[model samples]
Target: MDDQNNFGAQSTLSMPAESIPVESIPIESIPVESMPFESMFIKSIPIDLTSTPATNWDNQSQLILSFESMPIESIPVDLTCAPTTISDEGVKLQFDPKVIEKKYIEERDKRLRDDGIDQYVRLDQERQSDLYAGSPSPRDPIKKEVDFLIMGGGWGGLLIAVRLIQMGITNIKIVEKAGDFGGVWYWNRYPGAACDTESYIYMPLLEEMGYIPVEKYAKSPELRKHARAIGTKFGLYDKALFQTELLALDWDEESKRWAGTTNRNDNIRAKFVATASGPLHNAKVPRIPGLETFKGHSFHTNRWDYAYTGGDTLGNLDKISDKRIGIIGTGATSVQAIPHLAAGAKHLYVFQRTPSSVDVRNNQPTDPKWVDSLTPGWQKRRMENFNTIVTGGHADEDLVGDNWTDIIRKLSVLGGKNQSTASADNAAARQLADFQKMDEIRARIDNTVLDPATAEKLKPWYNQFCKRPCFHDTYLPAFNNPNVTLVDTDGQGVEKITEEGIVAGGKTYELDCIIYATGFEFVVNHTNKSSLTIRGREGLELSEKWKSGASTLHGLHSRGFPNLFIVSLMQSGLTPNLTHMLDEQAIHIAYIASYCVENGIEAVEATAEAENKWVQTVVELARLQQEFTKQCTPGYYNNEGKVSDVVLRNSWYGLGSPAFIELLRKWRKEGKLDGLAYETAH
Candidate 1:
C-alpha cells in the first residue's frame, strides 16, 4: 500500500505500467483488476510461443524478414512469449481494498455492531435442545450471591474455572446456555468433526487427566468428553447452572457486586463476573433467499440432525444413504463432512463459493507403544516445541510432524532465524516458503483429481494463510466418485435458495437435504459476541463503551468495568491453536483474581491511562497481522471481507502468545501489577 500521505498529482485512477514491481505500486494509486495486463498473453488466454520448434522459428524469422519487405498488414502480431510463473503479488486485488466505504459502514453500525446483535436472536431464551432428558432444575426462588460467577461452560468457562479453583478462588458458579458443558464440541457434532490440530496440544488438562488420545486428532466426542472430565475434575459441574441464559448484566456500585438476571427468572449476584462465552458457539446461517421456505430437511453443521443422518461422528450414515444431499459452503467443516456425505448420499452436491485450500491429511491412529514410552510433563514440553516452531520461532524437534508444522520445519532447515524473532528478511523468506507450500498443495490436487477442469477449479489462487488450510487424504479421491458433484460458483456465492434446491452459478441442484457447512460467526461485533448487555459502573453497556474499540490492560480486565473480567483471544497473544491461547488467558486471569483474593481486595479494574496505552500498542502490534488476514478470502477470521477499523484493533494480540505469556510471567515476577486500580477497605 502506498503511504496515504504521499499521493502524487496524477489522477487517483492512474496505474503504473506492468513492468513496475507490484510492491512499489501504492494501493491507492490503482485497483488490481483495472490495470492493463501484460502483453505476454495471447488474446484472453496465456501460452508459450517460445517453446516452438527450432525449424519453425527459422521459418518464422524468414517470414518476418519477408514481412519487412512487404506492407505493415503482412506482418503478424505475436501476443505471447514462453510461459512464466506468475507471482502472487501480480494477482490484482479482486476489487479496491476499500470495497466497503466509510459511510456505508456507519449506516451499517447497528446491524453489524456488538450492541445490536442481541436484537436478532432470542435474547431471553437458551438454544433449544432435546438431547438432554431433564428439564431446568427448580430455581432457588431468590437471588443468590457468590464470590465469582462465570458465564459459559465450554473451553473458556471450564478452563478458567479450573484455574480459579487452582488459585484457591472457590465459591464460584458457572452459568451455561447449553444443556451440557462442551461449548463448540457439544454443538458441532457433524459426522467428520474433529480437531484439526493434534489432540495432545489441543486438549487442556491432558496432564491432569493422564489420558492419551486414541488418534493424533481426537474426534468431537472425545473432545466433549474431555470438557466434561475437566468440569468434574474441578468440581465445576456441581456448581454449574444448565439451561440458563443471561438476559442482562449490570454492576451494583452500592453493594460493590455484579448482578445478573437469567432467562429462568432467577437473579444471581457475585463480587466478580467473568465472561468466557467462547466466540465459536454461535452458529450463523447465511441470509439466502427462501432459506426458511425449503421443504426438504435442513440443519446447520453445528447443530447436526443425528436422528435423520443415522450416524454419529463415526460415520455409518446408513439412514441418509438413499437421500440426495446438498451442502452450502466448503470450509473446514465442509471439508471433513463431505467425505462422509459423499459415501452415504445417493447423489451429493457441494456448492462452493470460494474453494478452500485443501492439503494432505494423513491421519493415523495413535500408537499405544508411543504412549507407553512417555515421560512426566511431556505434554507441556511437546506443546511448547510445537508452539515455538509454528509461531515463526525455532524448536529443537518437531514432535507432531504433520501439516501444521510442515512449513515452519522447512523454514527452520533453510534459515535458522525464521522463528518468532525473525527479521524482516526472514519474514519475507517465510512468505516465499508459504507460497511454495501452497503451490505444492495445489500440485497435489492436480495429481490426485482425475479431471483437469476439476483440479484447476480446486486449485486456490490466493496465499495459503488467507484462509484456514484444510487437509484430508480422502476428500479429493471422494470427488472422483460419480455421485459427488462440485458446484463452483467462481467467487459469487450461491445465487439463492429455492424450496427444492440451491441455485448456484446459474444452475440448480435438487436435493432431499441441505446441510449448512458455514462455521461459527467470530466476535467481530464487540457488543454481540455474547448476546448479553453488560453494563459497567457508569451504566454504560460494554458494547457502547467499546464503540470506539475494545481496550483491556491484559485482555483480562477492562477499565470502567470494575470487578468484571473477560476471557478471550483479543488483546492477548493470539495463537492459531485457540486452546493454547485459552490456557494462557486462564492462567493470567486466575493469577490476577487470586492476587485480589489473597490481599482482601474488593474491586479490580485497569486504569484508563494503562488501557489507552495497551490498546495503542495492541493496534500497532496487529498492523501486519491485520494486513495478512484482510488479504484472505472472506471468512470469520477476516469478517468475510467486511473488516472495519474497530474489528482489527479489538481482536488480537499481534506478535504471538509465547511472547505474551513471558511478558505476563515477568509482570507477576515483579510483584506489583502497575496501572491497575485495586479497591481496598479503608
Candidate 2:
C-alpha cells in the first residue's frame, strides 16, 4: 500500500494551454480542497512535466524549470506537507517544514518552563536554621528489626504497605520525614491545592477503599485523608517511624540482607526494603538572588506556612487581609492556589515567568449511581478508556479528562461534527485545529476577564503542550478582582528582589510576604546539605554517572545500579492523571517483587543488554511525540532548556500511560523479561 501517496495530495496532471480543449479539465477539478501547497518539496530544478499532458500551464519556454527539493531545512510546519515519493509519473508531498519547526520549538519551550523548571538557590545553613527556628528536628532514627521497611510514606508507599498486610506480609515499618503520611500531598497544601485531572481518575484505590470523592477534583484534605487511610487500613500506622529519615541503605552481600542507617546513626536490618520514596517528595526550591535576605515571610509552596497567613489547609486566609502577597510561579501548583489568594488577600501579585494554558475543568462530585455502575474492572476500564482516546485510538467515548488532548479525539471521528477526516490531509491539519481550539479557549479568557490588558497579558502565547495544561473555572475570574494583579515578566522572569519586595520591568511591588512557587532542580546539588549521595556498585555515584544526562530502562532501573529501582516517570507513560502513572509504576514494582519471591531469587538487576534496548525504544518512541510535547516551555518535560539530547532518553516515555502498561504486560508475559538478570542467594 502506498501510505505516503494516499495521505499527501491528489495527483494533478497539467497540459499545455494550446494542446488541451478548454473544457477537458474543469477549474473545480483542480482539487482546490485536496491540494495543500505546504506538502511539496522540489528535489531538482526540472521535472519531466511532459510525461503527463498539462491542462493549464501556458506553453512555457522549455517546460524545464528546476525546483529544489522544498528546502527540507525551511518547511513551515503550519502548512500541511504530506510525505511523498515521485517516479516519472508525478510528485508527492507533506507539510511546509519552516512552519512546523518554528511552531514546534515555541511549544516545546513552554512545556519545559512548565514542568522542567529550575534555578532555585538553596538557603544557607543559617537561613534554613532561622526558617525552622521553632520546629523540631526533621528526622528521628529507628533501631529495630522491622518486618518490612518502607522507605517512603507517600501514596505509593502507603498503598504498598497496605497491600503487603493484605497479603499477610505484616510486621511492617514505614519511614517518613514529614509529620504525616500524605507524602507530596501533605507538603503541598498551597492556596490552590486541588487536583487538575478529574479527582476520581487521579485518586487511586478509592473504590477499593469504599471512598467517594467530595469533588470531581479532589482537594488536599481529601487526598491527605486518603493517604492516611491507606496507612491506617493496612495497619501501617501501628509501627510507622514518622519524622524519621533514611540515611543510607547498603546490601550486606554476605547475609543477603540490607543494612539500613538513619541520620542519628541508628542501624537496623530488614529482609525486604521497599523504596517508596516518591520522586516528588523532595521539595525543589530554585536559587534566586536575595532569597536569603528577602526580609519578609517566604516559604516554598510544598511547605505551606499557615502561621504567616493565619489560615488552615482549606485556604481561608483571614490574616492576609492586611498583608500583600506575592507569588512567583504559574505551574500546576500555583494554578490551584492563586484563586484563593486573589479572593482573600488585601492585595495579590502574581509573578509569572511564563503562562500556563488554562482550560475549563468543570469539576463536580462523582454520581453515586455512576460509581456503583463501575464494577470489578472499573479502574482498568477507566485507564484504558483515557489512554485510547488521548493516543488517537478509536473509542466509544472519552471519560473523566477534557484537556486540550480531547481535540485529538474529536479530530479522529471521521464523520462527526467538525470532522477533520473529510480531507485525506486531516492528520496534518489536526494539530493546527487543536491549536485553534486552544486559541479559542485563551480568547475566552480575554472575554471572561474584566480588564482587557490583564487578559491579554495572561494569555499564553505558546502552544498548548509546551506545558501541562491546567483546568480551572476560578483562575481566570480571580484576576478580575480589584485586589488581584498579574505581573508578567515576559519570559526574562523577575529581575531581582529588594529588602521590601520584588523589582520587575523597572517597577517595584512591595509585599509583606513572598511565595516561591519556583520548582525543583533535576540534578540535586551534591554539595547541598539536604541532598543525600547515592553510591552504586564499585563506589560509582549516581550524580557522576548521570552528570551528562539521565538514563534508565522504562524509567525504573538503570545500568550498573543493580537492585536499585527509581520511583519516577522516566520513559514510562506519564499523563495528566498522575495516579494512572503511579499505579502503573506500582504494578511494575509489584511484579518485580513478586518475580523475585516466586523465583526464590536473592537479587535482580537490569542487564546492560536490556538497558540498551529499552533506551533505544524510549528514544524512538519519544521522537515520534516530540513534535507535540517538546513545544512546551522550559520545564522538566523537555529537561529544562536543554533540548535534543540522547542522554536522558528514558526521561518520560512519550507512549502515554496505557501503551506503556500494555508493553510491560507483554514483556512480563513473554517470560524472557528481555533485559533483566535474576540471581540466587549464595
- Measured against the true structure, the TM-scores of the candidates, in listed sequence, are 0.80, 0.78
lDDT of 2 by residue, 1-682 (tens): 0000001111111112233221112321221111111111111011223332333222321111122323323322323335433223222334343354465456444434433334544433333232222454545455777545777777777766655665556666777766778776766676667666566666778767877788777777888888888777766788677666677766555555556776666677765666666555445555556655678888777667777786766778878998999999887777778887887899999998778777777867768788777778676677656655554445666775565246454333311222212222333233333444455666778889989888877877654444556777888898989999999887767878889999888898998999877654443322122344555556566667766545667667766555555665555555555566667666666666666666677766677776666666556544433433334456555556554554246445433444456667766676665677767865
Candidate 2 steric clashes? 73
Give me the candidate number with maximum TM-score: 1
lDDT of each: 0.64, 0.58
Q: Per-residue error at 327 for model 2, in Å?
A: 1.5
| C-alpha root-mean-square deviation, candidate 1 | 13.1
Which whole-number lDDT from 0 to 100 does residue 204 have in model 1?
Answer: 85
Top model by lDDT, which number? 1
Q: RMSD, each candidate, Å?
A: 13.1, 12.4
